[model samples]
Target chain A: MSPLFTSAHEGTLAVSAGIGLLLLAASGWVSVLHRRKPGPGTRELVLRLRAWWVICALFLGAVLAGGRVGVLLFAFISYLAFKEYVSLIPFRRVDRRALFWAYLAIPVQYAFIWTGWYGMFTIFIPVYMFLIVPMRMVSLQETKGFLATVGMIHWGLMITVFCLGHAAWLFVQPLSGFPVAGAGGVVLFLVGLTEANDIAQFLWGKSLGRRKLLPGVSPGKTWAGLCGGVLTTAVLAGLLAPLLTPLPVRVAVPIGAGIGLFGFMGDVTLSALKRDLGVKDCGGILPGHGGILDRIDSLMFTAPLFLHFLRFYYA
Target chain B: MKALGQILRSLLFLAVAKPFVALVLGVDLRGRERLPKKGPALLVANHNSHLDTLVLMTLFSVRQLPGLRPVAAGDYFLRNRLLRWFSLRLVGVIPITRNHAVSGGHPLTPCLEALDRGEMLILFPEGSRGEPEARAPFKRGVAHLAKSRQEVRVVPVCLGGTGLALPRGEALFVPRVCRLVIGEAFTWTGDTTGFMSELEDRFAALEAEIAPPPFPSHPNMT
Candidate 1:
C-alpha cells in the first residue's frame, strides 16, 4: 500500500524517484538540444515538458493524498473533460437544460466511488442517465434531431464521466489479501503505463514512423510507433507491476500490451471525433497538449479496461 | 464611502458570479491586449446570449469595472423590482428603452451621458440576441452613440459560441468554448451611415479570425 507520501511504502516512493529522475533527464536533454541550436519544435517541446511536469506532480500528489482525494481529482478531471466534449460538439438549443443534467451526472457518479458503492457506480451513468437524457430531451418537446441529441448527451457522459470515473473507483477498491499498493498503486500503475505508452508511441512515430497506421483517422500514428509503444509498455508493466500491484510479471506484461492497444483505440476514436467536428484540438486548456480531452482520451479507454480487468481477475 | 461601497459590491458580485461563468464556458479571448486602458470608449460586440453581458463584464478587472456600463434593454432587464435593483446597483447596466417612441425621450441620452462622464459603455450593436452564432443587421444605435462623442474609441468584439452556450431563451448553460475576438480600436466619424458600415466591416473582420460556428450559417448576413 506504499504510494509515496501517503504511507512512504518503499515501492511507490521508488517509482516516484524514477519519475523524478526521468524528468531531470528530459529537461537536461531539452536544454542540451537548445544549446546546440534553436530548433522549430524546441520551444513547443519545452512547453509540453513543463506542462507534463505540473500534470505529473499534481497527479502523484492527488492519488497519494488518499482515496477521497483521488475520487475528487478524477471527478474534476471528468468535469473538465465533459465540459470540453459538449463545447466541441453542436446540439439543438432546446437540449441545453438536458445537457446541464448530463454535467450533473459527473458528481453523482464520483459520489458512488467516494462511498465505495461499486454497484451503483457501474450502472448509474450507463443505465440511469441513458433513460434520463432521452426523457429530458423529449420533455423539451423538440423532435428535430431529438434522438441525436439524446445520443450525444448519453455518449458524452459515458466517455468522459463514466469511463474516467472507473480510475477513481479503482482508488477505493480495497487492497486486502495482497497488500498491493492498495488502490493507489493500481491507479499509479494504470495511469503511468498508459501515459508512458502514449509518449513512447509519439516519440517512436516521430523518429522512425514509416507506414501510416490509420491515414484518414490519425495520419501521425505509424505501425512502427504502435509496435514500439506496445513493447516499451510491456517492459514497463513487467517492472512496475511487481513493485506497485499484486500482479506477477508474467500477467502484467500482457496487460501492458493490452493497454497499448486499447490506449490507441481510445486515442484514434477521439481523433475520429475531432475529425467529425473538424477541430484540431478540443480546447486550449493545456498549453501545448491541446485540451483536457486531448490529454485523457486514451485514459478513457484504459481506465475502464484496467478497472474491469482487475474486477474480473484479481479483485 | 460610496466609492468603497462600489468596490465592495463588485467584489461580492465577482465572488459568486465569476467562477460560475468560468466553470460553464471556457472563454478563449483573443486580442484582449487591445482593450482600451481608460474610459470614454465603446465596447461594441454582436449580441447573442444573455450570458454575453456577463461574460464581457468578467473581462474587466475590479478597478476597470466601476467605469464600465452595459447598455441593455430597459424593458427586458427592468421587468421586475428585484431585477431593477440588481441591474442598477450590481450590474451597472444603462438600460435604454428599445422603443423611444413609447418612452418619449432620446434613447441615446443614457449612453451619451455615460460617455460624457468619461465612462466606458458596452453596447451590442445588433440590438438584441439573434440566431445563435449568426450576425444580425447592425442596429444604428451604437453608430449613433459613437457619433455623439467624436473621440470615443470603438472596440469591436465578435463573440462566437455565446449563442450556443446560453442563447436567448435557455435557462441552463451548456458548457461551450466562447471565442471572443477583440479587434483594434477605432474612432467614430460624424456621419451615422458611414460609421455604421465601417462598424460592420470591423465586426466582419474580427469574426473571420475566430473558429467558424459549428452550426449552419444563418441565411441572413449583416
Candidate 2:
C-alpha cells in the first residue's frame, strides 16, 4: 500500500467518482425526459439530481483536502445548520440576548475540534454551555418563558453544533489499526451509507411501501422502506468497512443498521418540528433540498452515533 | 463639489455600510415591490433599535439612495460631531427637533422641504426607541405631514427583530435576522388622529405578517 493512496482507498475514490458519473448521466437523461413530458415532480427530481452533483463534488473536495480543512468544512456546515434552526424558532426578546452567546458557542466548539481537545470538545456544549447560557439569561432578570427558552437554545446548540461537531472530530480520531490515509475514506463511508439509506428508503417506499411507519409524524415513511433501507445499508456497510476502516465486517453490519435506524429517527424528529412550526422547509437556502436543516436532518443523528461507535470500538 | 461629495457618500453606503449591515443583521426586505421606482414618497416606520435607520437605508436601490433622506432625532444624532457627520454625510439624515421649544422652529420644516424637492423622506413616527417587541403610539407629526402633502405617497414600514438586534440601551449589536415589511403606498387626507390610528394598524398587521409561529410542543405531550 502506497502512503498517498492505498489500493483499497483508491478503489473507494474510484467508486465514488463512478457514482458521480452515474448521477450526472441520470441527470442528463432526466433533463431530456422532462423536456418531453414536464411535470412539477419531474422538474423537482431534475433539480434534485443537479444539486446532488454539486453536493457530491463539495463533499469529495473537502474529504480530499484532509486534516484541518475537513474539520473546518464540517464546522461551516454546523454554522449553517444553527442559522437555519435559529431562523425557524420563535425567540423571545430576552432570549435574543442569550442567542448571542449561543451563536458564539459554535466557533468555540469547533476550535476544540481543530485543536483536538477531546475532553473540552465533548463537555463544552453539554456541560459548560448548559450552565453558562442560563446564567447569562438570568443576569438579564427576565424570567418569562425562562425554562423553555434555555431548553430551546441548548437543544439547538446540541443538535447543530455538538452533534455535527463529532463528524469533524472523526478526522482527528486515532483508530488503532487504521492508516491515516484511510481517515477520509472512513468519513466518506459513514456519510455515503447514511445518505444512501435515505435514498433507498424513499425509493423502496415509493415502489413497494404500505403501512406507514409513523403516519402522524411522517406520512412518507413506511415499514417496507425501513426494512429495505436497513438491509441495503447493512450490506453496503459490510462491503465498504473493510476498505475504509479497521472494523471487521461483522461489526460494520450493526453500525450500518444503527445509522439507518437513527437516521430515520432524526428525519422524523425534524418532520415533527416542521409540522409544528407549520413550515414546509426551515429555509429556502438550498433549491430542491428545502434548507440546510432539511438536508442534514439525518446526519444530526448519524454523525454523533457513528463517532461514538468508532470511539468505543476502535479508539 | 456638493455633487461629488454626494456621489462619494452613496458609494460608501452601497459598498461598505449596506453589505456590512445586511450581513451582520441578516436583513430581509419584503414587499419591496410596493415602493415606487421614482417618486416623492414618505416612509414612516416603527423605531426600536439603531439598526432601524441602517436597515431602511440599505433597502433602497442605488439610484434611490441619493434621493432618500432619513429623518433622525436632532437631540440624539446632532449632539456628537462624528455622529452628526455620519447622519448628515453618510446616511443623509435630516435632524428634526423632538422638542419644539429647543429649536423654536417647525420640526416638519426640513421634512416638508425635502418632500417638496421630490426627495423621499424616511421618518420613525414613534419619535424614539420603545420597548422591544412593542410599539409606542405614532406621533401626530407623521399624520400632519401626510395630510399636508397629499401629493406625496405615505408608506408604512414595520421593522421586525431590530429591537432584539440592538434594542434601546444596549451598545453591543447582536446579529440576528431582521425583516422590513414595506406597506402599500397610499395617500392620506384624513384627520391626524384617524391617520395615526390607521398607520398604527398598518404596522401591527405587517408585524404579524412576518412573525414566526409559536414553538412546537413535545411529541409525547401531543
True contacts kept of each: 0.33, 0.31
Q: For model 2, state the Cα shift of residue A51 in Å.
A: 7.0
DockQ of model 2 vs. true complex:
0.24
Q: Write the per-residue lDDT of candidate 1 for residues B85-189, one digit (tens) a residue.
A: 778888899998988688777888988989999999999878889788888898888777777787889998888888977877667666777888889898877
Model 1 spans > 4 angstroms off: A1-8, A17-43, A178-181, B1-4, B79-81, B99-110, B116-118, B208-222
Find the 10 residues in a row with the least total lDDT in model 2 chain A: A1-10
Give model 2's docking category. acceptable
Q: lDDT per residue, candidate 2, A1-315, as tens digits?
A: 122222335745765777778887898899988999999988898878777887788777767655666787888788778877876777766677788899899889988987889999999999999999999999989777778778888999999999988888877777787776666777888888889999888998999998898999999999999999988899999988887778899899999999999888888999998998788888655567877789999988999999999999988
Q: By TM-score, who's the top model here? A: 1
lDDT of 2 by residue, B1-222 (tens): 778878888788888877777544565567888876765888888888888888887887788888889998888898989988777887888888888887766778988888888999888888888897678878889877888788788888888878877888878666666767889888785677777778778888898987766555732111
| TM-score of chain A, all candidates | 0.94, 0.94
**lDDT of model 1, residue A161:** 94
- Provide the clashing-pair count of each candidate structure: 0, 0
